[model samples]
Target: MIQLPYPRLNVIFEALRYEALPQQELAQRCDISTRTIRTDISALNDILASYGAQIQHQRGKGYHFDIYDETRFLDIEKQTKKMKSSPRNAKDRMVYLMMRLLSQEEECKLDDLANQWFVSRTSLQADMGEIREQLEQYNLELISKAHCGLRLFGEEQAIRACIAHILFQFKPSDHTFIDVCEYFFPEINQPSLKTDLLELINKNHIKLTDEGLHHLVVYCGVALHRLKQNACIHHVDQPNLSEEAQKTAAELSQTIESLLGAPLPQAEIDYLSIQIAARRVTGVPEIDTQKPTEQLELTQYLLDYVNTHYNYDLRNDEQLKRDLLCHITTMILRVKYQITIPNPLFDHIKRYYPLAYDMTVAAISHWGKHLIPDGEIGYLVMHIGVGLERNFSLEEQLPPKALLVCDSGTSIVRLLESQLIRSLPQLTIEKVESLRDYEELSKVDADFVISTEKVSQKNKPTITVSPIPTSFQLEQVNKLILMNRSHPYMLDKFFDHRYFSVLDEPMTQGEVLKKFSAHFTEDNITPIEFYDSVIERESITSTILGEGIAIPHSLGLLANETKVYTIISPHGVDWGNGKIAHVIFLFAINKDDYEEAMSLYDLFVTFMNGKAVDTILGCHSYDEFQYVAKECWFNRKKDW
Candidate 1:
């Protein structure tokens, strides 16, 4: 019997249980493309044919399993269950290999690992390259001896941190504390261990968040495992912990040492204190006297930076101020001591809160002091995201005001006003005037203008509707109301025909960026150093938002003037890692106009939907692109 690949295991199980599953459903479950699912199904049928079973696909339904000889199929299933349970994907294999090396007392041999996993030594060696790259981020390394083999060489604290991060990667959000302990450290008495730790933590009055408590427990368990192998931290830097944190660490150490039946070194105790200090939530003391001056100043600086750069005046938000004061207290320690805390919601936050994440990144980059890791950045983004949401909610609560300009009789105007009020309850009609009166006014003091006649107003948005508005016309009015709430006027000012291009030929990301950069440089819009900074930013993280869309920009505000260079590639450009970019928006933002950055980022996000990207790609001229983009933006206003 052939050993089943890990990716195919789920497909086979679903086939055996259900009569059929749709191709899209299977692809979603496995987190692969429909094309890849089709390929995997073919391979599975080939393997099953030899065992008197095959997978068949229906036109409307999906894949189904058929077995001719029950005995043969049963044998194959048993063989699959008994096969060696090694990791089958590169990511899992690398993680397993790193854990093995970290836990081993002696050097590990590639040959031994290859044989254990049933892979070639060459493949194992290739994975080692990736492992080394990942370890570099944690300040850990792998050293090879001439004859013995390879062993992990790094600070004991760093090794423990790396181990905690690996374990966190495998922890599901719904997992209980004991469930995690059982999976990572099966030999320990998890129930008793957890009870003891909680008792000590409560006894000492050491406050911790739910995630913080989980991290502390996992770290203690990891320390115990390492100590059993005689691998203990001999030296560590002194951490600036509070009196409460120090006492908690002392008691926690005693509990861990009792479980190990040994005394922990003072260095280990100090390291544990640092971990406790980093995770403990400091209470917001009386703001007038107990808060540290330095922390207050830093928090004020961050708030001011956001206000000046992102146009978010959160300086008066007392709740946001207190939350920042509390979070930054521990965050400073984590940065100073190089502590690594895994954020489980990092991916979700980045996906849904791109504007907040970018603003946070820009703010931190402007701080220009310590190098903050992405994990810490994720936490800061959460605080800023809440502030943004609060501002949006307050804006939404205020009913929008509109001026009615109708060229009908007084009775007709009254009827139209009544109809509008019934349809749009949230709208406040500030004034009702005739067309001649509206045209005679020097300025319109309303959010938008609703007219029954063809009227032109450049200052405020104008929408024309029938004397009695239809459903579609009301929808247009509603969309206009939503758009006015956000005031996303940056689209018209930044995107211009002069800066747009349609590239029919294929190009690399580097080639396209450099070409755009050079053009801007010649036009005196950006310095020559702009291209390098953009490349450095891309190296940090790919700008590809997936689905043939990419928004590449510099590390900081590098352009002399703000402009968006739009590119439409009929033939897709390579954006690294098998991603292609059909619609690229290379952002050239200036510091003076940084307040508009959020709106600009939102515009790119609007194009991230597959349909919007396809519509943009179909346009051949700048005028056509502009019209299609505006339609897409208007249609997606509800998402804002």
Candidate 2:
């Protein structure tokens, strides 16, 4: 049933889009003769018509097409819907598309499919054979009876099994799904799927390679969860689960319980675990309740954090509350997942956090940090982080050691500055440009600048900040630089935490010392000593940020990075009896930069949101990754 990939369709579509072209012209553009152009145009137009759009002839123009761009999309949707019934098509594409939909929807009609595909019933029936073969790779079945036409059958559970195949394709290169899934599926820590998928590849005698299987695992999890709730509601005779799968799920449940400290209902653990494993092992996709639960938790956390930490209660307005929660969720998912930024997602974030958008982009480029949130939330950080982290100083020198530069946001930034200074002796203060003078700043000679969002460039080191950055973001920025709170990358514009709660590790004292000597400063305390000093932090709190990333350093000094050294262990270090792939250890050089460290710490927090560390690990070379650290440090410099 395997068919050669049809590159021709894309070419045909492109060729037909021309206003009108001579046979010779089309041949040049499409590398096809006038004869081929005519053939493909006919094929494209036939399909286009079913979708409510037509590829009309251009007046006197050869190879030209008349099309309604907006309406043409309807054709796409219709074709897409048709494929949903069963992966049956005149061409192989419709067959593949349809099969996926049919598998999801559990039904389709041959006559409708035939009409939509612009093919005779006989020709389409022939094509359905090809579709069946293709589905067989993932154990997909195309069950066709004389009356039934053609439909997808077999275990729906395998949907996740198939989906995990292309999860990375839907993801941006910077974020890795495996890492984020690390948090969601704590039960499968070693990523045993790597082995399982490999075995499946060999057994299926299918085309997808190990790499393909690797991604499919997560994509399947996501898709299965997405569909399990509603898409699969209509299906009959779904697949069954094996006991081996159940046992595995229970083990996973135990793991998550260990990580969360409090045990989730064992029944919930059992159900979710089975669901996750079923989607992987069985040919049927299992349902996922993780996203909904996670979102609910995040909203609650936001409300709590904002009220207690930021002194603002956004819950007063139900609409704003919902909107903001949705906004943040999408942002975190996009960045965490490292998925492309959808236009609407960007528009929404820009609509709500416009000033932070451009700044966040600038910060990423400057820091050489790559952030791919599904929307403009990543952009928002650029707006604020860049304003806060600065290379130079401002006029204000106060405690908690950061300055405020918001234009008209109720002095929240100032209040934050004051509150932070109380705990930190290194705290300093500075003037918001709106309230102070150039001369005054020169007199004070502030070490950094902090602003609510991007406005203009400053002569000194600065950290642009969001009035209320997420707690995760705060943790990352705070740990990167200790100066004030500046995300210097943004005018310079926009920018970007901590695992104070790291799990226990059993590293040898000597091993710890070597980590220090090779990477740490010559200061009296060695890395091993620091590890020992903070080892208690692990027991008290868990520091495993999602994405196979962990950060462990002296509790009091973890956020300060006056002097710096970093390590990237792709293999992941053992923490809390769990394996972590990317762990960042930081030490600050100056006593003064400590207050500025919050933003640096917050950077990690921001990244931990979804799939940050995994994306970081995907980087192939040192040159590709160093800027993230540079951006973090510069962005973390405080404003005061």
Cα lDDT for residue 38, candidate 2: 70
Give lDDT tens digits, candidate 2, residues 525-601.
Answer: 24444555445444433344434455454434432234433445555565553344355543432334543543444
Clashes of 2: 144
Those runs of model 1 whose alpha carbons end farther than 4 Å from true positions after fitting are: 1-85, 172-186, 287-297, 307-318, 366-369, 388-490, 521-548, 555-561, 569-582, 590-597, 609-611, 637-640
What's the lDDT for candidate 2?
0.44
Model 2 TM-score, 2 decimals: 0.25
lDDT minimum window of 10 residues, candidate 1: 172-181
TM-score against native, each model: 0.77, 0.25
By lDDT, who's the top model here?
1
Task: Please identify model 2 stretches exceeding 4 Å from their true place.
Answer: 1-155, 158-161, 164-294, 302-321, 327-514, 517-563, 566-585, 588-595, 598-640
